[model samples]
Target: MTTRTILAAAALALVPALASAECGWEKRINANTCGEGQTFDTATGTCVDQSTS
Candidate 1:
């Protein structure tokens, strides 16, 4: 294949990957309902004290 054709194919292949890629940070608009001064811990899947965190 020609150099230009190879480059075009490579660019086309990357189009879907770039389009499907998730960009930007996720924001939590609402606060966690795990009581006062407590946050939800993903590791243990429970509310943990803020002091320890």
Candidate 2:
């Protein structure tokens, strides 16, 4: 009925969505697509250069 009441309702509606958020790297990483001299790094979720002599 009042401004404060409406805002409270809106905030409560958003609580569930905020709580269900996914915290991590991208959904999936296709390591097979890495470059010839590179490899996928799980820790950083990226392709990195492979060490060689």
The numbered model that scores best in lDDT is 2
Clashing pairs in 2: none
Give candidate 2's TM-score.
Answer: 0.42
Per-residue alpha-carbon lDDT of model 1 for 1-53, expressed as tens digits?
Answer: 99999999999999988776644344332336588887788776677778952
**Sequence-dependent TM-score of model 1:** 0.42
Q: What local distance difference test score does each model get?
A: 0.73, 0.84
Clashes of each: 0, 0
Q: Give, for candidate 2, the lowest lDDT window spanning 10 residues.
A: 21-30
Task: List model 2 lDDT by residue over 1-53, tens digit each.
Answer: 99999999999999987777754434666588788999999899888999897
